[model samples]
Target: MRMVKVEASVSLRRDLDTGTEMQRDAVDNIITQVIEQGDHALYTLTKTLDGAELDQLRVTEAEMEAAYAQMDEELIGALREAMTNIRDFHQRQLRQSWLTTKEDGTILGQQITALDSVGVYVPGGKAAYPSSIMMNVIPAQVAGVKRIVMVSPPQADGSLPAGVLVTASELGVEEIYKVGGAQAVAALAYGTESITPVDKITGPGNIYVALAKRAVFGKVDIDMIAGPSEIVVLADETGDPGYIAADLLSQAEHDERASAVLVTTSNELAEQVSVEVEKQLALLPRKDIAAASIRDYGVIYVARDIAEAIHVVNELAPEHLELLTKEPMNLVGKIRHAGAIFVGSYSSEPVGDYFAGPNHVLPTNGTARFSSPLNVDDFIKKSSIIAYSKEALEANGSKISALARLEGLEAHARAIDIRLEGNK
Candidate 1:
């Protein structure tokens, strides 16, 4: 990991601008082709990028059943437990339509409705993310989404991952497709013969997937254009170097583009952590990927004090912020931007990523400054409802007509005029 002196101007905006513009253009091309060519384009892109021959794009019932039967009892039990916790967390976020009436018989309320259908994209091939299956589907399920369709790239044998199938089945997601990447996104955005278009698509994926989601934003709602996984640890003298090193590596191992940074007031702890990272990197199976991530994006910044460290953290707006100081809670109030805050040494990033109740699918590339983590709220819409009795209309009609006329909307004024005339 590189040691950089913490600068006052360093902020999340700086980090957001790090990716190459050429990558963005390449992603745009995928989106253009997917939109124009539809299913045929999806198949061609899949074969070219995934290096997998494709015949059928959707998963069969037999495969789902076989996957359920193949899974071990222990693994099934664990998935069931995680599902329950996730369900409970999201269930608390569910809201109902409400109405209120006044003495004049005026009624107003907000009607909360779940989405009709949703699509979840899970990465396949070398990266089979069953955790993503749980994170994306559970909220939609909790929000009462009627149809939850899933898309993933198929294996060379054109088979869905057993773990993915098992997870989807457990979550009651009946519609699973084997298509993935930008093409699968296209299929979800616009209906193909084999796949139904969804109201919204949510999940994490490669740059192509992110760019595809950006392209199809108006066509379908997306959670966010998530970038690589990231973690920023704010520690003090009391924080453990070993624990800090372990937490940093947890995110770095995700991918070569992933970032793990440390901002500390103590230089002694920084040196200890720098050494500990090297020692721990040797034991990791993904050492090469983690090392590359560390070499490129990782940093240890020595701050003048904890306040400066906190300032830097807020500016960064990291996806996962770990506060490892003596009084983590005291600093919590100071944190203005972060996808999720892990308060103490025990509250590591992985805990939230896997077993913890909070959603792991979070805003990346400093998007936490304005965006949010995926939640049950993402799957529901709110509609405002208003009704007025004749007496109530008589009371407010003049003001309504005046305001509408002032805005040069004569039709709106005429509508109110008609109501008033009926009352007279």
Candidate 2:
């Protein structure tokens, strides 16, 4: 890891992936094919892209039973426990419909309602991310969203992973489909014979999936375009070098583009952590990937003082921030940006990723500056309520007309005038 002096300005904001021309053209072609050919395009694309010849798109009851059988008792118990924690956490975020009555007989409020349907795109490849299934699906379920669909690419044998299947089944996600990539996104955006269109699509995918989501934005709502994982550990002289190094490596192993940074007030601790990171990097199973990440994007910034370190952290606005300082709690209120803050040496990054109750799908690539984590709010919509009484309108009609006419909107002014005249 490279060591650098904290400058007046510092940042780790990577440019979002705006797919290459070829990729965008390919995604456009895929979307057009799905819209024109419907289920036929899904079948053909699944064979070409995933090399799987499938007779059925939907997972059957027998498949679900088999998925459950393949899982061990211990793993099932762990998943159930995680589910309970996640459900409980999101239940607190649920909003209620509220209205207020004014003295002039006017009712104004906001109505909270769940989306009619939602589609969750679970990526399929080298690993099965059952945790993602829980993070994305549980919130929608908690938000009272009906008809949640799950889609993922199938294996060469035309079978989805047992862990993925079991996780979806455990979450009560009945509408499971074996389709992925831009085609699956298209099917969710525009209905096919087999899969109905959903009101919104939420999940992470490859570049193609990201572009597909971009293309279908106005047609249906989507979660933000996520970037690579990032972590920043802010520590002082009292911080443990080994614990900080271990936490940094946890994020570095994620991908070659992932960033892990340490900003500390102690120059001694920075050097020690740099050494520890190199020592531990050799023992990791994904040593090549982690090595490349640490070589390219990892860094340790030596700040002049604790205040300078916090200022640098805010400027970076990392996706995951860990405070390993002596007074970690006191500094939390000063942190203006960061997707999630892990306090002390014990709260490692992975703790939030898998077992922790909070949703792991957080804002990345410096988006934490303005964005937020995935929650129940993403799966629901809010509508403003207004019931104008005769008294309320009579009292304010001329002012409304004057304001409308000020904007050169005669029809708006006339609408108010007509109501006032009829009442008079």
Candidate 3:
């Protein structure tokens, strides 16, 4: 970590951008092949891209049973506990189809309906992310979505990770597939003989997965396009230098592009955290990766006060934010942006990533300014309810026509006119 003095009029969000070629050509080529060749393309691409040849695309019932049976009781208990927490949290976010009546006999409300099906993409690259299975599947399950299909790259042995498979099975995700990358996304977006097309897709992945999700948008709903993992810690004089350094490294080790920034009011704390980060980074197994991330993108901004630190935090809109000041709760109301806020040193960012009830699939790359963490809402659709009584239509028909005609849409105005005539 390097210390940088926050200057007036200087933008702190300069690094908050992803210009990866969108892997557009490769994504387009892969998606085209999947649409053109169906299951064969999935099979061929798995071997070509992931270097794992798979005779089976779907995880078999036997595989699910084996994964469960092989897992130790401790892991099973931990996963179940985490799943329960996630399920309980999302259940609070579940909405019901509502209809409110009016004296005018005009019924207007929203009908909340679960999507028919959804696909969850779990990355199976260097490590197994069993937490992704819980975070992605539980919300859809809580939203009353009928079908949830899960896809992930296979291990080197061409089998689904036991942790991922067992977790998915425990959470009632019955349709698990052993396919990944842009090809898997194509099969989910547009249907194949083996895998059915879904109404929406959710989860994070590599650049190819992100590009594929972008390509398939409008064709199939997708969660926001995720960029590299990032975390920005906001601290004041009372903050712990050790806690700050360890927390930032948690995200830095995820990828070389992943960013870890510390914005503090005290220059002394900034230097202390930089030294602490180096001391901790030396002992990490992924030190090289974290070092590259810290060397290339890591930064510590010295602010004049808590207000200036908060300003930098809002402008950057980091994926994860930690408030290590004496008054984290008070400052939260002033924050306009940030995907997730971990108050105090006790509320570490990974708490939400795993066992905490909140969804870990959050917006990144300054998107937290507008987007939200994944929730049950992502798995459901809403239809505006409108049942106009004859009296109500008569009361508003002329006004509706005037507004429509003002927009030069005669047909829109005529639509109301025809309905008025029909009632007459």
**Which candidate has the top score in lDDT?**
2
Candidate 2 or 3, higher TM-score? 2
Residue pairs in collision within model 3:
none
Better of 2 and 3 by lDDT: 2
TM-score on alpha carbons, each prediction: 0.92, 0.98, 0.95
The residue pairs in collision within model 2 are: none
Global lDDT of each candidate? 0.87, 0.93, 0.89
On the 0 to 100 scale, the lDDT of residue 330 in model 1 is 95
**Model 3 agreement with the true structure over 85-192: per-residue lDDT tens digits:** 999999999888889878889999999999999999999966789998888889998998889999999977788878888888888788888899999899999989
Best by TM-score: 2
> How much is the lDDT of residue 311 in candidate 3?
89
Clashes of each: 0, 0, 0
lDDT of 2 by residue, 21-66 (tens): 9999999999999999999999999999999999999999999999
Residue 367 lDDT (model 1): 86
Q: Name model 2 segments beyond 4 Å from true.
A: none
Candidate 2 has an lDDT of 0.93
